[model samples]
Target: MERVYIGMGSNLAAPAEQLREALKALGQLPHTRLSGVSSFYVSDSLLPGQPRYTNAVAALDTALEPLALLDALQAIENGQGRERLERWGPRTLDLDILLFGDRLIDEPRLKVPHYHMQARAFVLYPLAELAPGITLADGRALDGLLAACPFEGLERL
Candidate 1:
Protein backbone atom coordinates (compact mmCIF):
# COMPACT_ATOMS: atom_id res chain seq x y z
CA MET A 1 0.00 0.00 0.00
CA GLU A 2 1.19 3.48 -0.81
CA ARG A 3 1.27 6.18 1.81
CA VAL A 4 -0.84 9.18 0.91
CA TYR A 5 -1.34 12.60 2.39
CA ILE A 6 -4.55 14.54 1.92
CA GLY A 7 -5.12 18.24 2.56
CA MET A 8 -8.59 19.08 3.85
CA GLY A 9 -10.39 22.37 4.43
CA SER A 10 -13.85 23.64 5.13
CA ASN A 11 -15.49 26.95 5.93
CA LEU A 12 -19.19 26.17 5.86
CA ALA A 13 -21.58 24.13 7.99
CA ALA A 14 -19.53 23.50 11.11
CA PRO A 15 -16.13 23.18 9.49
CA ALA A 16 -14.51 21.15 12.21
CA GLU A 17 -17.36 18.66 12.25
CA GLN A 18 -17.20 18.37 8.51
CA LEU A 19 -13.51 17.36 8.76
CA ARG A 20 -14.26 14.87 11.52
CA GLU A 21 -16.91 13.31 9.29
CA ALA A 22 -14.48 13.31 6.42
CA LEU A 23 -11.89 11.55 8.54
CA LYS A 24 -14.38 8.81 9.39
CA ALA A 25 -15.33 8.43 5.75
CA LEU A 26 -11.68 8.27 4.74
CA GLY A 27 -11.14 5.41 7.12
CA GLN A 28 -13.99 3.57 5.47
CA LEU A 29 -12.63 3.65 1.96
CA PRO A 30 -11.90 0.28 0.41
CA HIS A 31 -8.27 -0.87 0.52
CA THR A 32 -7.44 2.06 2.73
CA ARG A 33 -6.59 2.79 6.32
CA LEU A 34 -6.52 6.21 7.96
CA SER A 35 -3.10 6.35 9.57
CA GLY A 36 -2.72 9.89 10.86
CA VAL A 37 -4.44 13.25 11.07
CA SER A 38 -3.19 16.71 11.95
CA SER A 39 -4.57 19.26 14.34
CA PHE A 40 -7.20 21.51 12.81
CA TYR A 41 -5.99 25.02 12.06
CA VAL A 42 -8.10 28.05 11.36
CA SER A 43 -7.05 30.50 8.63
CA ASP A 44 -8.71 33.36 6.85
CA SER A 45 -10.26 32.52 3.55
CA LEU A 46 -8.62 33.42 0.26
CA LEU A 47 -11.29 35.92 -0.63
CA PRO A 48 -12.67 38.69 1.51
CA GLY A 49 -16.15 38.48 3.01
CA GLN A 50 -15.78 34.72 3.38
CA PRO A 51 -15.67 32.81 6.60
CA ARG A 52 -12.36 31.60 8.02
CA TYR A 53 -11.43 28.07 6.98
CA THR A 54 -10.69 25.06 9.14
CA ASN A 55 -7.88 23.01 7.66
CA ALA A 56 -5.95 19.85 8.41
CA VAL A 57 -3.98 17.04 6.79
CA ALA A 58 -4.63 13.32 6.77
CA ALA A 59 -2.28 10.41 6.17
CA LEU A 60 -3.56 7.20 4.65
CA ASP A 61 -2.09 3.89 3.64
CA THR A 62 -4.02 2.70 0.65
CA ALA A 63 -3.78 0.19 -2.15
CA LEU A 64 -6.12 2.18 -4.35
CA GLU A 65 -4.53 4.01 -7.26
CA PRO A 66 -4.22 7.77 -7.40
CA LEU A 67 -7.25 8.53 -9.52
CA ALA A 68 -9.37 6.11 -7.58
CA LEU A 69 -8.39 7.81 -4.37
CA LEU A 70 -9.08 11.18 -5.92
CA ASP A 71 -12.52 10.00 -6.94
CA ALA A 72 -13.27 8.85 -3.42
CA LEU A 73 -12.08 12.17 -1.98
CA GLN A 74 -14.28 14.17 -4.34
CA ALA A 75 -17.23 11.99 -3.43
CA ILE A 76 -16.60 12.73 0.21
CA GLU A 77 -16.44 16.45 -0.53
CA ASN A 78 -19.66 16.36 -2.52
CA GLY A 79 -21.37 14.40 0.22
CA GLN A 80 -20.34 17.14 2.62
CA GLY A 81 -22.00 19.77 0.37
CA ARG A 82 -18.91 21.16 -1.37
CA GLU A 83 -19.69 23.53 -4.20
CA ARG A 84 -17.50 24.69 -7.10
CA LEU A 85 -18.96 28.13 -7.31
CA GLU A 86 -15.77 30.15 -7.74
CA ARG A 87 -12.02 29.93 -7.57
CA TRP A 88 -10.81 30.08 -3.96
CA GLY A 89 -14.39 30.48 -2.89
CA PRO A 90 -15.88 29.24 0.35
CA ARG A 91 -16.85 25.61 0.57
CA THR A 92 -18.36 23.02 2.86
CA LEU A 93 -15.34 20.73 2.37
CA ASP A 94 -12.30 20.60 0.13
CA LEU A 95 -9.81 17.74 -0.17
CA ASP A 96 -6.69 17.66 -2.28
CA ILE A 97 -4.20 14.91 -3.01
CA LEU A 98 -1.02 16.26 -1.47
CA LEU A 99 1.29 13.31 -2.12
CA PHE A 100 1.01 9.71 -3.19
CA GLY A 101 3.91 7.48 -2.32
CA ASP A 102 6.67 9.75 -3.59
CA ARG A 103 5.24 9.64 -7.08
CA LEU A 104 5.07 12.72 -9.23
CA ILE A 105 1.70 12.76 -10.91
CA ASP A 106 0.47 15.36 -13.35
CA GLU A 107 -3.01 14.68 -14.59
CA PRO A 108 -5.78 16.86 -15.85
CA ARG A 109 -7.79 15.94 -12.79
CA LEU A 110 -5.01 15.99 -10.21
CA LYS A 111 -1.44 16.86 -9.34
CA VAL A 112 0.68 15.31 -6.66
CA PRO A 113 2.98 17.55 -4.55
CA HIS A 114 0.09 19.98 -5.07
CA TYR A 115 0.95 22.90 -7.31
CA HIS A 116 0.48 25.55 -4.64
CA MET A 117 1.27 23.78 -1.38
CA GLN A 118 4.74 25.28 -0.94
CA ALA A 119 3.17 28.71 -0.46
CA ARG A 120 0.22 27.85 1.76
CA ALA A 121 0.88 27.73 5.47
CA PHE A 122 -2.48 26.09 6.06
CA VAL A 123 -1.35 23.11 4.00
CA LEU A 124 2.34 23.01 4.83
CA TYR A 125 2.13 23.41 8.60
CA PRO A 126 -0.57 20.81 9.15
CA LEU A 127 1.26 18.49 6.82
CA ALA A 128 4.37 18.91 8.95
CA GLU A 129 2.40 17.49 11.88
CA LEU A 130 1.74 14.25 10.03
CA ALA A 131 5.06 13.87 8.25
CA PRO A 132 8.02 15.67 9.68
CA GLY A 133 11.34 16.08 7.85
CA ILE A 134 9.83 14.85 4.65
CA THR A 135 10.51 15.46 0.97
CA LEU A 136 8.05 15.66 -1.84
CA ALA A 137 8.01 13.57 -4.97
CA ASP A 138 9.22 16.63 -6.86
CA GLY A 139 12.27 16.92 -4.60
CA ARG A 140 11.03 19.81 -2.49
CA ALA A 141 12.02 19.50 1.14
CA LEU A 142 9.29 19.98 3.70
CA ASP A 143 11.53 21.93 6.04
CA GLY A 144 12.51 24.22 3.23
CA LEU A 145 8.92 24.80 2.34
CA LEU A 146 8.08 25.53 5.96
CA ALA A 147 10.89 28.07 6.10
CA ALA A 148 9.52 29.83 3.05
CA CYS A 149 5.90 29.79 4.22
CA PRO A 150 5.31 31.55 7.48
CA PHE A 151 2.67 30.27 9.85
CA GLU A 152 1.00 33.64 10.08
CA GLY A 153 -2.73 33.97 10.77
CA LEU A 154 -2.96 30.27 11.42
CA GLU A 155 -4.23 29.16 14.78
CA ARG A 156 -3.99 25.52 15.74
CA LEU A 157 -7.08 24.13 17.43
Candidate 2:
Protein backbone atom coordinates (compact mmCIF):
# COMPACT_ATOMS: atom_id res chain seq x y z
CA MET A 1 0.00 0.00 0.00
CA GLU A 2 1.12 3.53 -0.71
CA ARG A 3 0.93 6.21 1.92
CA VAL A 4 -0.99 9.27 0.82
CA TYR A 5 -2.41 12.49 2.22
CA ILE A 6 -5.60 14.32 1.36
CA GLY A 7 -6.27 17.98 2.11
CA MET A 8 -9.91 18.69 2.86
CA GLY A 9 -11.85 21.91 3.23
CA SER A 10 -15.42 23.12 3.25
CA ASN A 11 -16.90 26.57 3.65
CA LEU A 12 -20.60 25.82 3.22
CA ALA A 13 -23.04 24.07 5.49
CA ALA A 14 -21.64 22.33 8.54
CA PRO A 15 -18.09 22.13 7.27
CA ALA A 16 -16.82 20.13 10.19
CA GLU A 17 -19.45 17.49 9.66
CA GLN A 18 -18.86 17.46 5.93
CA LEU A 19 -15.17 16.97 6.45
CA ARG A 20 -15.77 14.05 8.81
CA GLU A 21 -18.25 12.46 6.47
CA ALA A 22 -15.87 12.90 3.57
CA LEU A 23 -13.13 11.15 5.50
CA LYS A 24 -15.40 8.27 6.33
CA ALA A 25 -16.42 7.93 2.71
CA LEU A 26 -12.82 7.97 1.60
CA GLY A 27 -11.99 5.25 4.08
CA GLN A 28 -14.71 3.08 2.68
CA LEU A 29 -13.24 3.05 -0.79
CA PRO A 30 -11.88 -0.27 -1.93
CA HIS A 31 -8.21 -0.87 -1.12
CA THR A 32 -7.96 2.28 0.94
CA ARG A 33 -7.60 2.51 4.67
CA LEU A 34 -7.86 5.68 6.69
CA SER A 35 -4.72 5.94 8.77
CA GLY A 36 -4.88 9.30 10.48
CA VAL A 37 -6.87 12.51 10.52
CA SER A 38 -6.00 15.99 11.78
CA SER A 39 -8.14 18.27 13.89
CA PHE A 40 -10.50 20.59 12.03
CA TYR A 41 -9.27 24.16 11.56
CA VAL A 42 -10.79 27.39 10.45
CA SER A 43 -8.90 29.50 7.92
CA ASP A 44 -9.61 32.65 6.02
CA SER A 45 -10.24 31.92 2.38
CA LEU A 46 -7.59 32.87 -0.13
CA LEU A 47 -10.20 33.94 -2.61
CA PRO A 48 -11.84 37.27 -1.91
CA GLY A 49 -15.50 37.21 -0.84
CA GLN A 50 -15.39 33.54 0.00
CA PRO A 51 -16.52 32.20 3.33
CA ARG A 52 -14.05 30.99 5.96
CA TYR A 53 -13.33 27.30 5.53
CA THR A 54 -12.88 24.44 7.92
CA ASN A 55 -9.86 22.40 6.81
CA ALA A 56 -8.26 19.15 7.80
CA VAL A 57 -5.96 16.50 6.40
CA ALA A 58 -6.24 12.76 6.25
CA ALA A 59 -3.58 10.07 5.90
CA LEU A 60 -4.44 6.90 4.06
CA ASP A 61 -2.85 3.67 3.00
CA THR A 62 -4.09 2.75 -0.45
CA ALA A 63 -3.41 0.35 -3.24
CA LEU A 64 -4.86 2.63 -5.91
CA GLU A 65 -2.68 4.47 -8.35
CA PRO A 66 -2.39 8.23 -7.98
CA LEU A 67 -4.90 9.04 -10.68
CA ALA A 68 -7.34 6.50 -9.35
CA LEU A 69 -6.98 7.92 -5.88
CA LEU A 70 -7.66 11.39 -7.20
CA ASP A 71 -10.83 10.13 -8.82
CA ALA A 72 -11.89 8.53 -5.58
CA LEU A 73 -11.42 11.80 -3.71
CA GLN A 74 -13.43 13.71 -6.29
CA ALA A 75 -16.15 11.10 -6.02
CA ILE A 76 -16.24 11.63 -2.27
CA GLU A 77 -16.54 15.37 -2.78
CA ASN A 78 -19.40 14.93 -5.24
CA GLY A 79 -21.07 12.61 -2.79
CA GLN A 80 -21.02 15.46 -0.27
CA GLY A 81 -22.96 17.74 -2.66
CA ARG A 82 -20.05 19.74 -3.99
CA GLU A 83 -20.78 21.89 -6.99
CA ARG A 84 -17.83 23.54 -8.68
CA LEU A 85 -18.98 26.83 -10.05
CA GLU A 86 -15.70 28.76 -10.05
CA ARG A 87 -12.08 28.52 -9.19
CA TRP A 88 -11.62 28.33 -5.44
CA GLY A 89 -15.30 28.89 -5.01
CA PRO A 90 -17.09 27.99 -1.81
CA ARG A 91 -18.26 24.42 -1.79
CA THR A 92 -19.76 21.74 0.42
CA LEU A 93 -16.45 19.91 0.31
CA ASP A 94 -13.09 20.14 -1.42
CA LEU A 95 -10.71 17.26 -1.43
CA ASP A 96 -7.23 17.53 -2.85
CA ILE A 97 -4.55 14.95 -3.23
CA LEU A 98 -1.68 16.41 -1.25
CA LEU A 99 0.81 13.58 -1.53
CA PHE A 100 0.95 10.16 -3.13
CA GLY A 101 3.55 7.74 -1.96
CA ASP A 102 7.03 9.17 -2.65
CA ARG A 103 6.42 9.85 -6.30
CA LEU A 104 6.43 13.19 -8.05
CA ILE A 105 3.97 13.30 -10.89
CA ASP A 106 3.24 16.35 -12.98
CA GLU A 107 0.52 16.26 -15.57
CA PRO A 108 -2.03 18.57 -17.11
CA ARG A 109 -4.67 17.48 -14.59
CA LEU A 110 -2.69 16.46 -11.54
CA LYS A 111 0.49 17.20 -9.65
CA VAL A 112 1.58 14.97 -6.86
CA PRO A 113 3.45 16.44 -3.90
CA HIS A 114 0.94 19.05 -5.08
CA TYR A 115 2.50 21.90 -7.04
CA HIS A 116 1.25 24.45 -4.52
CA MET A 117 1.53 22.34 -1.38
CA GLN A 118 4.50 24.16 0.06
CA ALA A 119 2.93 27.56 -0.35
CA ARG A 120 -0.54 27.04 1.10
CA ALA A 121 -0.79 27.20 4.86
CA PHE A 122 -4.36 25.97 4.79
CA VAL A 123 -3.12 22.76 3.21
CA LEU A 124 0.21 22.42 4.97
CA TYR A 125 -0.82 23.04 8.55
CA PRO A 126 -3.44 20.34 8.69
CA LEU A 127 -1.37 17.96 6.60
CA ALA A 128 1.58 18.33 8.93
CA GLU A 129 -0.67 17.82 11.89
CA LEU A 130 -1.84 14.52 10.47
CA ALA A 131 1.47 13.28 9.14
CA PRO A 132 4.30 15.34 10.53
CA GLY A 133 6.91 12.74 9.77
CA ILE A 134 6.03 12.33 6.12
CA THR A 135 8.80 12.78 3.60
CA LEU A 136 7.85 14.20 0.24
CA ALA A 137 9.00 12.82 -3.07
CA ASP A 138 11.66 15.51 -3.11
CA GLY A 139 13.00 14.13 0.17
CA ARG A 140 11.98 17.10 2.33
CA ALA A 141 10.17 16.29 5.51
CA LEU A 142 6.63 17.62 5.97
CA ASP A 143 7.55 19.21 9.29
CA GLY A 144 10.55 20.90 7.71
CA LEU A 145 8.42 22.50 5.02
CA LEU A 146 5.85 23.58 7.60
CA ALA A 147 8.54 25.16 9.77
CA ALA A 148 9.28 27.63 7.00
CA CYS A 149 5.66 28.56 6.39
CA PRO A 150 4.61 32.05 7.46
CA PHE A 151 0.86 31.95 6.85
CA GLU A 152 -1.14 33.10 9.87
CA GLY A 153 -4.83 32.56 9.23
CA LEU A 154 -5.23 29.05 10.57
CA GLU A 155 -6.75 28.19 13.93
CA ARG A 156 -7.81 24.84 15.31
CA LEU A 157 -11.56 24.26 15.37
Candidate 3:
Protein backbone atom coordinates (compact mmCIF):
# COMPACT_ATOMS: atom_id res chain seq x y z
CA MET A 1 0.00 0.00 0.00
CA GLU A 2 1.25 3.48 -0.82
CA ARG A 3 1.23 6.13 1.87
CA VAL A 4 -0.77 9.19 0.85
CA TYR A 5 -1.47 12.53 2.43
CA ILE A 6 -4.75 14.36 1.91
CA GLY A 7 -5.51 17.95 2.87
CA MET A 8 -9.03 18.76 3.90
CA GLY A 9 -10.84 22.02 4.57
CA SER A 10 -14.31 23.39 4.98
CA ASN A 11 -15.88 26.79 5.52
CA LEU A 12 -19.55 26.26 4.85
CA ALA A 13 -22.06 24.57 7.12
CA ALA A 14 -20.45 22.98 10.18
CA PRO A 15 -16.82 23.08 9.05
CA ALA A 16 -15.30 21.03 11.87
CA GLU A 17 -18.07 18.45 11.71
CA GLN A 18 -17.56 18.16 7.95
CA LEU A 19 -13.91 17.32 8.47
CA ARG A 20 -14.75 14.70 11.12
CA GLU A 21 -17.21 13.01 8.80
CA ALA A 22 -14.75 13.20 5.93
CA LEU A 23 -12.16 11.39 8.04
CA LYS A 24 -14.61 8.58 8.69
CA ALA A 25 -15.42 8.35 4.98
CA LEU A 26 -11.73 8.29 4.12
CA GLY A 27 -11.18 5.31 6.38
CA GLN A 28 -13.98 3.50 4.63
CA LEU A 29 -12.58 3.93 1.11
CA PRO A 30 -12.03 0.62 -0.68
CA HIS A 31 -8.48 -0.66 -0.32
CA THR A 32 -7.59 2.28 1.89
CA ARG A 33 -7.08 2.88 5.61
CA LEU A 34 -6.79 6.12 7.48
CA SER A 35 -3.53 6.01 9.42
CA GLY A 36 -3.10 9.47 10.92
CA VAL A 37 -5.02 12.70 11.26
CA SER A 38 -3.83 16.10 12.45
CA SER A 39 -5.54 18.38 14.92
CA PHE A 40 -8.16 20.65 13.38
CA TYR A 41 -7.17 24.27 12.79
CA VAL A 42 -9.05 27.40 11.88
CA SER A 43 -7.63 29.82 9.34
CA ASP A 44 -8.81 32.92 7.55
CA SER A 45 -9.92 32.33 4.01
CA LEU A 46 -7.26 32.59 1.34
CA LEU A 47 -9.55 34.98 -0.46
CA PRO A 48 -10.85 37.97 1.41
CA GLY A 49 -14.53 38.27 2.31
CA GLN A 50 -15.01 34.52 2.70
CA PRO A 51 -15.62 32.63 5.90
CA ARG A 52 -12.78 31.17 7.96
CA TYR A 53 -11.86 27.55 7.27
CA THR A 54 -11.28 24.54 9.46
CA ASN A 55 -8.47 22.45 8.08
CA ALA A 56 -6.57 19.23 8.76
CA VAL A 57 -4.36 16.66 7.11
CA ALA A 58 -4.96 12.94 6.83
CA ALA A 59 -2.56 10.08 6.17
CA LEU A 60 -3.80 7.03 4.34
CA ASP A 61 -2.39 3.69 3.32
CA THR A 62 -3.97 2.75 0.02
CA ALA A 63 -3.57 0.37 -2.86
CA LEU A 64 -5.44 2.61 -5.28
CA GLU A 65 -3.53 4.52 -7.93
CA PRO A 66 -3.27 8.30 -7.72
CA LEU A 67 -6.08 9.05 -10.12
CA ALA A 68 -8.37 6.54 -8.51
CA LEU A 69 -7.60 7.97 -5.11
CA LEU A 70 -8.31 11.44 -6.42
CA ASP A 71 -11.65 10.25 -7.69
CA ALA A 72 -12.51 8.77 -4.35
CA LEU A 73 -11.62 12.01 -2.58
CA GLN A 74 -13.71 14.04 -4.97
CA ALA A 75 -16.62 11.70 -4.42
CA ILE A 76 -16.38 12.27 -0.72
CA GLU A 77 -16.35 16.05 -1.22
CA ASN A 78 -19.36 15.88 -3.50
CA GLY A 79 -21.19 13.71 -1.01
CA GLN A 80 -20.53 16.37 1.60
CA GLY A 81 -22.01 19.11 -0.65
CA ARG A 82 -18.90 20.60 -2.24
CA GLU A 83 -19.61 22.88 -5.16
CA ARG A 84 -17.25 24.43 -7.66
CA LEU A 85 -19.13 27.65 -8.06
CA GLU A 86 -16.01 29.78 -8.15
CA ARG A 87 -12.30 29.39 -7.94
CA TRP A 88 -11.14 29.61 -4.32
CA GLY A 89 -14.73 30.13 -3.30
CA PRO A 90 -16.12 28.91 0.00
CA ARG A 91 -17.21 25.30 0.09
CA THR A 92 -18.87 22.71 2.26
CA LEU A 93 -15.81 20.48 1.89
CA ASP A 94 -12.55 20.57 -0.04
CA LEU A 95 -10.26 17.58 -0.35
CA ASP A 96 -6.88 17.79 -2.02
CA ILE A 97 -4.19 15.20 -2.64
CA LEU A 98 -1.22 16.76 -0.90
CA LEU A 99 1.21 13.94 -1.61
CA PHE A 100 1.20 10.37 -2.87
CA GLY A 101 4.07 8.58 -1.27
CA ASP A 102 7.25 9.90 -2.92
CA ARG A 103 5.81 9.99 -6.39
CA LEU A 104 5.66 13.15 -8.50
CA ILE A 105 2.69 13.63 -10.76
CA ASP A 106 1.57 16.49 -12.99
CA GLU A 107 -1.60 15.78 -14.82
CA PRO A 108 -4.38 17.81 -16.36
CA ARG A 109 -6.70 17.00 -13.47
CA LEU A 110 -4.30 16.40 -10.59
CA LYS A 111 -0.97 17.42 -9.19
CA VAL A 112 0.90 15.66 -6.43
CA PRO A 113 2.64 17.48 -3.59
CA HIS A 114 -0.24 19.86 -4.27
CA TYR A 115 1.18 22.70 -6.40
CA HIS A 116 0.86 25.26 -3.61
CA MET A 117 1.34 23.27 -0.38
CA GLN A 118 4.78 24.67 0.27
CA ALA A 119 3.50 28.22 0.44
CA ARG A 120 0.32 27.79 2.46
CA ALA A 121 0.46 27.40 6.23
CA PHE A 122 -3.04 26.03 6.25
CA VAL A 123 -1.68 22.95 4.49
CA LEU A 124 1.88 22.86 5.76
CA TYR A 125 1.33 23.38 9.50
CA PRO A 126 -1.08 20.52 10.05
CA LEU A 127 0.80 18.37 7.57
CA ALA A 128 4.00 18.95 9.54
CA GLU A 129 2.14 17.97 12.70
CA LEU A 130 1.37 14.58 11.20
CA ALA A 131 4.45 13.88 9.09
CA PRO A 132 7.28 16.05 10.35
CA GLY A 133 10.54 15.41 8.52
CA ILE A 134 8.78 13.91 5.55
CA THR A 135 10.46 14.83 2.27
CA LEU A 136 8.90 15.52 -1.05
CA ALA A 137 9.92 13.84 -4.28
CA ASP A 138 12.02 16.91 -5.02
CA GLY A 139 13.87 16.34 -1.69
CA ARG A 140 12.52 19.34 0.24
CA ALA A 141 11.73 18.54 3.87
CA LEU A 142 8.22 19.22 5.13
CA ASP A 143 9.45 20.83 8.35
CA GLY A 144 11.63 23.19 6.35
CA LEU A 145 8.74 24.09 4.11
CA LEU A 146 6.57 24.81 7.12
CA ALA A 147 9.21 27.18 8.41
CA ALA A 148 9.28 29.17 5.20
CA CYS A 149 5.53 29.28 4.62
CA PRO A 150 3.99 32.68 5.24
CA PHE A 151 2.09 32.71 8.50
CA GLU A 152 -1.63 32.76 8.02
CA GLY A 153 -3.92 33.12 10.99
CA LEU A 154 -4.15 29.47 12.05
CA GLU A 155 -5.46 28.39 15.44
CA ARG A 156 -5.63 24.76 16.58
CA LEU A 157 -8.98 23.54 17.81
Taking all chains together, each candidate's TM-score versus the true structure is 0.98, 0.93, 0.97
Residue 157 in candidate 1, Cα distance off native in Å: 0.5
Question: Number of clashing pairs, model 3?
Answer: 0
How would you encode candidate 1's per-residue C-alpha lDDT over 1-157 as one tens digit per residue? 9999999999999999999999999999999999999999999987889999999999999999999999999999999998898878889999999999989998999888898899899999999999999999898899999999999999999
Candidate 3 C-alpha lDDT tens digits along 1-157: 9999999999999999999999999999999999999999999998989999999999999999999999999999999999999888999999999999999899999988799888889899898888888899878898789778866588989
- Weakest ten-residue segment in model 1 by summed lDDT: 81-90
Count of backbone clashes, every candidate in sequence: 0, 0, 0
What's the CA RMSD for each of the models?
A: 0.7, 1.4, 0.9
lDDT of each: 0.95, 0.87, 0.92
Q: RMSD to the native, candidate 3?
A: 0.9
Give the better candidate number (1 or 3) by lDDT. Answer: 1
The CA lDDT at 83 in model 2 is: 93
State which candidate, 1 or 3, has the greater TM-score.
1
Candidate 1, residue 91: the lDDT equals: 93
Clashes of 2: 0
